[model samples]
Target chain A: MELVEKYLYAIGKKLPRKQKRDIVEELRSLIIDNLEDRVKEGEPTDEDISQILIEMGSPAEVAKKYCTGTQWLIGPQLYDMYLMMCKIVLGALLLGYSVSIVVSLFSSLSGSGFGQIMWYIAKNLLSIIPGILAAIGAVTLIFAIIERTSKKPLDIDFAEGGKWNPSKLEPIPKKEEVVKPIESILGIVFTVFVLVLFYFYRDKIGFYYMSSLGDNWVMVKIFSQSALRTYLPLWTISWVLSLGMYIWLLCIGKYNMLARVFEMIVSALNIGILFFMANGPHLFEFDKLGADFIDLQPAVDFLTNNQSTIFYILAVLSIFGLLANLGKLIVGKVKGRI
Target chain B: MGNNQHTTDGLIQELRRGTLVLSVLSQLKRPQYGYSLVQCLAQKGLNIEQSTLYPLLRRLEKQELLKSDWELTGTRPRRYYQLNENGKEMLQELSDEWNRLAEVVKKLTQEEEIK
Candidate 1:
């Protein structure tokens, strides 16, 4: 009686885990008991069991009494969709920034060059972080609505094949495909931590060099108060943007074309911003050159005056990093790792 | 059926829905298997869907109002259900409540009849 077995199996799919086996066994016996009582008068056929199953009603309706506590903001069913929305937002941000960089390159070929521009963008990475938080919030809000409004949670097959199997429940992610949400979250936290540190206690960035003369030590204030005050507004903007990148990474769990492009844009912008900031101010202070370091005073002063040059040099070196990530993104896309 | 009959069916189903647990509990004093319970209820002119009754029995069992066990009798296995101590207590309380409700309904219906 494959038909009868199939019916029991369908009903079995709906029962809670602990009670599934016992309920199925008891139900099977009941159905068989009914079948035998009917066939006592004559021979049994599949048709008889089919009629029995029909009278039993839907498996969902039967399963309803047994099921408990499915209410949630975004249950397992909508988790993937929520993640997708986050990816789309992040990807859009990345594309927008990349396009902006490309446009800037085309228009502004006269001043401070690519290196300075990239360094400027890199430094402002902090201000962009809040955008990530907002994107995640938006996705969560939409999914919460969907979860609440859905008439029947079971209407969507949260599990593949409409029945849960341990093997199929959570397939092992490939190395390249893993999202590393923890790492992304940590990076966001680190960024926020740095911002807080910079705001409250930034004068501690100088050098403590021991003099060769006689254990005489002197402290140099490397970072100026003006760095925090003047750049606070710009830093806030870039921090919010950086927050978006981290949040998108956390929510989406993995990088795709969009994330890669977003990364590229963010990297480019960061480098550019750092370069721009370098051009604007001393950015660093080495006023306490001491007696021994007076010979290097001219070099220190030149670097201090042209801090943007250092960022430009660093930005050129970071191109290798951006290229490597872009390569990984391309490869991951081809392999369906994304 | 017509719209009038549709409303009647829906209303009657709602009425029957409330009494299903009571109806099943009334008969679980003696051990009865799935088909046997269905036949017992059907014979008494209380029609319950076989699918409905089986799950209902399982739910009542879960609620500790009914207990069930599988028995191998004759050629095959059969699951026999009987009211447990909890079920007996519930049945008694529910029976008393049903009686009061039925009495009140009868009085009201008699008034309708008079009208």
Candidate 2:
């Protein structure tokens, strides 16, 4: 009985503090009672008592039986959601950090002083927004997982027979109650606002910036005259495409399947646009417009020096975003099944 | 002849087995110590093994159907068991159901035997 007490104590120590004492006392009483009954039946040997204890099963098994009720609050159902959130957050952070470092290096190499430094910092911060969101999401997901696994109130439903009868209990509103519609509305409003802003501010924004010119004689002359001209249209086109994609995503991306398909299409369009912009003029005979454009030296140098690197970076980021959306889609599918 | 007797005894045991739990529960409604309870039930023709009765008592206590209190009478302390509130309710329901089912079974079996 002393040995059994010691065994029970060891097992009880593993359990939560609140339950340990009652369980230990009950176990002790049971063992002693059994032992005394055995002794009266003429099986009074020490060896026999030890053999009986051994035959009854391990201390852990006994402890487990006592602790079996209400094992988890949210249960084992939401484990997949936790894992998916983890992947998204980690991937976002990795992508953000890499892009920040690369962009910072480019800005420093370009030698564009204090304004450029401020721009670099602002851009990096903006780029890291998704990463920060991912981190917060990951932390929340971990808390949710812990809450699910712990057999606590608010998450646990402890009725006999393993069926979730919601009619028996009150329901709490879900997180998506406020955020989902708000997010969709904000996304659409922001996209439309940016488009309008760009349309109205085009001239003011591009006044000193000579790269807004089309492929006319005057525009060719302007391009030949200015070193920044060739790069401006490229930036404008890229920005418009990005904004277009954002609006498209906001409009049609409520469903995971549609969002994933849209993401793929946008990713492909980005790559295709970058490819054409990098090599378009050479194939289109825009080089043969006049003497001013015929040289093509300034435009070629500008495109050669900057286009490939910029396009490569954008392509990578877009692919990363696409992969993140894909991750979201897979998570949604898994969550649906669960 | 002894083998035939043993077979008949085993058949009787099997036939009477389902009533053992109800019989034990009914006795424990009145506060009774373990050994005394066993002797009392045996006198009523519901003979049960000590091993089986002890475990069943413990299980009932665990299920909150039985309550026990230890009283030291003479040299050794004896644990007395009694039916709890839940146990009383369950016992009443079980008794009612058993009577109804037994009557139906008796009617059917008697009619078949007559035919």
The residue-by-residue lDDT of candidate 1 on A250-297, one tens digit each, is 766766557778778878777766776767765777766888778878
> Best-fitting candidate, measured by lDDT?
1
lDDT agreement of model 2 with the native:
0.59
Q: Over the stretch A1-338, how does candidate 2's per-residue lDDT look in tens digits?
A: 56676777777876667857755654555556667656776645767667656754566666554554557533455554445444434543554455445434443334456677677767876866775776666567665666766554433465558766667663443443222534544543444344433343222221111122422212221122132344345545555555555444433334335555765775766666666555443221222234434465666556546755666677777778878867877786799699
Which regions of candidate 2 are displaced past 4 Å?
A14-16, A40-46, A83-338, B1-27, B31-64, B73-81, B94-115
- Once fitted onto the true fold, the runs of candidate 1 whose alpha carbons sit more than 4 angstroms away are A41-43, A68-338, B1-4, B109-115
For candidate 1, lDDT tens digit of each residue in B27-106?
98999887888999999999988767777787788789988888887877778889999999999998899999999999
Give fnat, all candidates: 0.68, 0.00
Chain B TM-score, one value per candidate, order as shown: 0.91, 0.85
Model 1, position A14, has a per-residue lDDT of 78
Best by TM-score: 1
